[model samples]
Target: MTDALLVLNAGSSSVKFALYEAAQPGEPPLLAGQIERIGDDPRLATGGTSEPFGQSTDGHAALIGGLLAAIGDLAPGDVRIVGAGHRVVHGGARFDAPVPIGDAVIAELEALTPLAPQHQPHNLAGIAAVAAAYPDIPQVAAFDTAFHRSQSEIAERYALPRGYAEQGMIAYGFHGLSYASIAPRLPALLGPEARRVVVAHLGHGCSMAALLDGRSVATTMGFTALEGLPMGTRSGSIDPGLVLHLLSERGMDVDAVHRLLYDESGLLGLSGISGDMRDLLASDAPEARFAVDYFVDRCARAVGSLAVSLGGLDALVFTGGIGENAGEIREAVGARHAWLAIPPPLAIATDEEGVIAEATARLV
Candidate 1:
C-alpha cells in the first residue's frame, strides 16, 4: 500500500479534509473535499461528486467519521493513510511550531480552548477523532498562531497591567498557517519588494499580518481571533465598555454576550441577511451593500495600521475567500490606500491544508 498523509481542518459547522501522497512534494492533493452543514442537512463532496452523508449524528466526531468512511469507499485501494495533521487554531505561548500530538500535548492544547472557544474545541475534536480512527498512526498539530510567535513584545502586549502579559493575556494571532504559506511565496511573486508585506486573510474568520522579511512583526488579531477584522459571524474588535453595559444594564449573561459577539454580529448582524460575502455580493439589498462596504472600510483601515507597524509597505497580499474572489472589495480597499504607492494587491489562494500536510510529512 502507498503511504498518504491526511490533513483535517474542522470548523464549527464543517470539516475540510485532504489526502496527499506521502512522498509527493509541491503537488496537489490526491483527494480533497469537505463536509458542510454538519448539524443541518450534512452533505459530502469529493472530486465533483456530491451526496448525502447519511449520518444521523452531528459535531466533529460524526463529521470526521463520515469523511473517513467516505474516503475509504472512494479512494484508491493502494492509498493507505499513514499519518495525519490537524489545523489547531490556538497554540498559546507553549507551541511555536508543529509538534507531534501525544496525551500530554493534547491536555495542554485542551487547556487553550478558552482562548479560542469557537475553533480550538473543534480542532481538538478533529485530532481526537483521527486518533481514534487510526490508532497506530502518528499525528501532528500545525497551529494557526505559531507563526506569529515572532511578534515583538510591544506588538504582542496589551495596555493592561504587566501581570496580564505574564499570565498569557497578550496577543496570540490567528491565521499564522495561512500567513506562513503566503510569506514564502511573496518574494518569488513580488521580487525583493516583498520585504515589508501586509497580508490580509479575509474568509469567514478574517485577520491581517505584517511580515518583515517573511517573519511576523505584528498582526491585527490580538489575544483572540475575535480581536481582528469583522468576520462572517464574529464581532472582531469591540469596546469593553459596551460588553460591561450589556452585562449590567441590559441583563445579558456571559454566555449571551459571547453568542452575540462570536455568532450573531459582524456581517450577519450588520446586514440582517447572511454572513457570507457571496450572498451579500449577489443581493441587491441596501443593507447587504452596507455590510460589504463596512467590511472593506475596516480592512482598508487595518492595512493602514499594519503599514505603520512595518514602517512602510512594499506589497499587500490578499488571500482567503473574500480576498481572492471579491474583486470589488479588493478594489475598494486598494483605492482607499492609493497613497501608499504599493504594488497592486496580489490575490493568492491560500494553501492551509497543503501547509498542514507538509508539516505532518516532516514528522513521518
Candidate 2:
C-alpha cells in the first residue's frame, strides 16, 4: 500500500479532493476529482468524465464515503491515506499558518464563520466528514488567509476606529493558497526580475494580490472576499453607505442585502444573462458585452492599484479558472496596462491542492 496525503477544498455545493504521495511532495496528485452539485444533482467529475453520484441522508459524510470508494478503485491494492489537509478559508488573526487539526482549532475556525459565511461552514463540514472517515489519520488546516499575514499592518488595516482594528476588523485577504502555489514558480518563470509581481486569481470568486519579492504586500480583497473585483456572483467592493441606505430607505433587511450582493449580483446582475464568463463572452447581447467590459475595467484598475503598492510592476501573473482559460479577458486587461511597459502577462495554473499536500506533509 502506498502512503498518500488527502487534500480537500469544500465549497457550498462541492468537495474538491486530490491525493498525493506523501513521500513525493511536489508531484501531481495520484487521483484528483470533485463531487459537484451535491444537493440537487450530485456527480463525480474525474478523468474528464462526469458520472452520477447517489445521494445519502448524511450530507457530506455520505459524499465523502463515495469519494473514498472511488479512490479505492483507482489503485492496485489498498492505498493508505497517511494525512489529510483541508482548505479552511478565513483563518482571521488567530492563525497565520497551517496548524494541526484539533477540537480547539476547529472551535477557533468555527468562530470565524461570520467573516466568510459562504465558505466557512462548508469547509468545517468537510473537515468533520474527513475526521469521521479517517479518525486516526493526522489532519492539518491550511488557511487561505495565512500567506497574507506577511502583509504590512497598514495594508491590512481598515479606516475604521482603532478599537475596531484591535478587535480583528483588519483586511485578511483570501486566495492565499492559490497565490502560495504561484509564488515559488515565479523565480523559475521570471528569473531575477521576479521581485515585484501582481497575481490576479480570477475565478468564480476573484481576487488579486500584490507580491513584493514573493510575499504579499497588498491585495484587492479586504476583511471579506466580497471587497474585491466583481466576481461570478459577488458584488465586490460596493460603497458602505449604499448598504446602510438599503437597510433604511429601500425596505431591505440584512439578509436580503446579503443575498442580493452574494447571489444576485456580479456578471449575472450586470448582464441579466449568466454569471459564467464563458456564457457572457459567447453571447451577442449588449448587456453581456457591457458585463465583460466592466469586468476587464475593474481588473485593469486593480492591477494599477496593486502596482502602486508594489512600487512598480515587474510582471503580472494570472491564475484560477477565468485567468488560465479566458484569453480574451487576459488580452483586454493587458491592453489597458500597456503604459506600464512591463513584460507580457503570464498565465499560470495554480496548484492549491499541491500546496495543501506539502503543508500537510511538513506538519505531519
Candidate 3:
C-alpha cells in the first residue's frame, strides 16, 4: 500500500484537510479540501469538487468520520493514510517544535485551551477524532505559535508583572505555520536581501511577523490571538483599560466582555453587517467602507511597527485569505507604507497544511 500523510486543521465550525503522498522535498499535496459551515449547512469539497456531506450529526467525531470515509472512497484502495498531523493553535511555552501527540501530550494541550479558547478546543477535538478513527496511526501536532518561538524575550513580554510573563502569560504569536510555510520561499523571491522581511497574515484571524534571516524576530500577536490586528470578528489589540471600564462602569461580566470582544467586534462590529471582507467590499454602506479602511490602516500601522523591529525592511509579503485575494486591501495597505521604500508587497498563497504534513512526516 502507498503511504500518505493526512493533515487536519480543525477550527470552531470547520475542518480543513490535505493529503500528501509521503514527504518529497519541495513537493505539493496530492489533494486538499474542507468541510465548512458545520452545524448549519455542512458541505464537503475536495480537489475543487463541492458536495453536501449529508451527515446529520453535528458532533466532531461524526464530521471527521464522514470526511475520512469520503477520502477513502476517493483515493485508490492501495493508498493508505499512514499518519496524521494537526494544526494546534496554541502550544503555550512548552512546545517549541512539532511533537508527537500522545495521551500525555493531549492532556498538556488540553490545559492550553484557556489560552486559545476559540481554537484549541476545536484543534484538540480533531486530534481526538483522528485517534479514535485511526488509533495506530502516528500523529503530530504542529503548533501555530511554534514558529514565533524565536522572538526575543523582550519582544514576547507584556508590561505586566515579570512573574506573569514567566508563567506563560506572554506574547505567543499565532499563524506561525502560515509564516513558516512561506519563509523559505522569500530568499528565492527577493534574493539574499530579503533577510529583513515583514509578513502580514490577514484572514479571519490576523497578525504580522518580523523575520530576520527567515527567523521570527518579533510579531504583533501577544499572549493570545486577539492581541494583534483587528480580525473578522475579533477586536484585536484593544486597550486593557477599556475592558476594565466595561466591567466596572458598564456592569459587564467576564463572559459578556469575552463575547463582545471575541464575537461582536472587528469588521463585523464596525460594519454592523458582516465580518467578511468580501461582503464589506461589495456593500455601498458607509459603515462597510469605514471597516475596510480601518483594516487597511491597522495593517499599515503594523507593517510600520514591524519594520522598526527589523531595523529596516527589505521586503514585505502578504499572505492568508484577505492578503492574497483582496487586491484593493493590499494596494491600500502597501500605499500607506510607500515612504519606507520597501518593495511592492508580494502576495503568496500560504500552505499551512502542507507545512504540517512535512513536520509530521519528519516525526513519523
Candidate 4:
C-alpha cells in the first residue's frame, strides 16, 4: 500500500478527517469525511451513509472510533496510514513548532489543559487514540502556536505581573498552523509583497496574523485565544474588570465565566440565533445582520492594527470556513483597507490536510 497521511480536526460534536496520499510534496487530499453528533446522531458518517465506526457517549471518543474504522476500510494498498498529524491549540512556551507525538508529549499537553481547556484536552485525546490504534504509525502535533513563535515580546506579553508572565501566563497566539500554511505561499502568489502580509484565519475559531518577512510579528489573539476578534461562540476581548465584577459583584464563578465567554458570546450571543456566518448572511433579521457586521468590523479593525505592525500591508489572505467561502466577508474586509495603495488581494487558503501531510512527511 502506498503510504497515507491522515489529518484530524476533532471538534465538540464532530470529527473531521482528511486522507492524503503520502506523496513527496503532499499534493492533494484523496478522501475527506466527518462523523457528527456522537451519541445523538448515532451514525458513523455525518450524512448517515456509513455505520458508526465506534459508538460513543463522549464527543472525543466518538471521533477516535469513527476515524479508526474509516482507515480500516480505505484499503489504499501500501498506502497505510504511515503518519498522523493533529492540530493542537496552545502549545504554551514549550512547543512553538510541530513536533512528534509521544507519551511524554501527551502528558505535557495534558498539563496545559488550563491554558486551553476547551481545545487542548480533546486534541490530546485524538493524538492518544491514533497512537494506540496504529502503534507503528508516527503521530505528530502541528501546533497552532508554532507559527506565532516569532512574535516579538511586545506582541506576546500580557500587561500582568512579571511572575505570571514567567509562569507561562503570557500571550501565545493560536491559529499559527493556518497562518504558517498561507505565509510561504504568499511569495509565490503575491511576489515581493507577500513579504509583508496580513492573513485572516476566520472560522468557528478565528484569528489573524501579520507576517513580516514570513515571520509572525503581530496577531489578533493575545495571552489566550479569548483575546482576539469575537469567534463563533467565544468572546474575543473583554475588559478584565468585567470578569472581576462578575465574580465579586454578580457572584459568578470561574465556570460560569467560562460558560459565558466561550458558549454564550460572539455571534450566538449577539444574534440569539446561530453562530454560523452563512446562516447569518442568509437571514434578514436585524440581529443576524448585526452579528455579521460585528464579526466583519472586528476583523477589519484587526487588519488595520496588524498592518501598522508591518508598517503597511502588501496583500491579504483569507483562510478557514468564513474567510474562504464567505465572499461577502472577503469583499467587505478588503474594502475596508481599499484606502491602502494596494488593497490586499484575497485568495483561498491552501489545503490544511496537505500542510499536515507535508509536516508529517518531513518528521516521520
Evaluate model 1: give its lDDT.
Answer: 0.89
Model 3 CA deviation exceeding 4 Å by range: 23-26, 37-41, 54-62
Mark the regions of model 4 whose C-alpha exceeds 4 Å error after superposition: 11-14, 23-25, 35-58, 74-78
Give one clash count per candidate, in the order shown: 0, 0, 1, 8
Off by over 4 Å in 1: 37-41, 49-57
Of 1 and 2, which scores higher on TM-score? 1
Q: Which 10 successive residues of model 3 have the least lDDT summed?
A: 23-32
Local distance difference test, per candidate? 0.89, 0.89, 0.87, 0.79
Cα lDDT tens digits for candidate 2, 1-364: 8998999987645678998888996897888888876655788898799988876344665787767766778544567998999999889998989999999999999999888987898788878877887899999999999999998889999888899999999999999999999998899999977699999999878999999888999999989878999998899999999999999999999999999998889988999998889889999999999999999999999999999998999999999889999999999999998899988889999988989999999999
lDDT string, candidate 4, 239-265, tens digits:
889999999999899999999998789
Global Cα lDDT for candidate 4: 0.79
Clashes of 4: 8
TM-score sort, best first: 1, 3, 2, 4
TM-score for all models, in order of appearance: 0.96, 0.94, 0.95, 0.90
The worst-scoring run of ten residues by lDDT in candidate 2 lies at 55-64
Minimal lDDT window, size 10, model 4: 39-48
Record all residue pairs in model 1 with backbone atoms less than 3 Å apart, i.e. clashing: none
Q: Model 3 over residues 242-281: C-alpha lDDT tens digits?
A: 9999999999999999999888899999999988888999
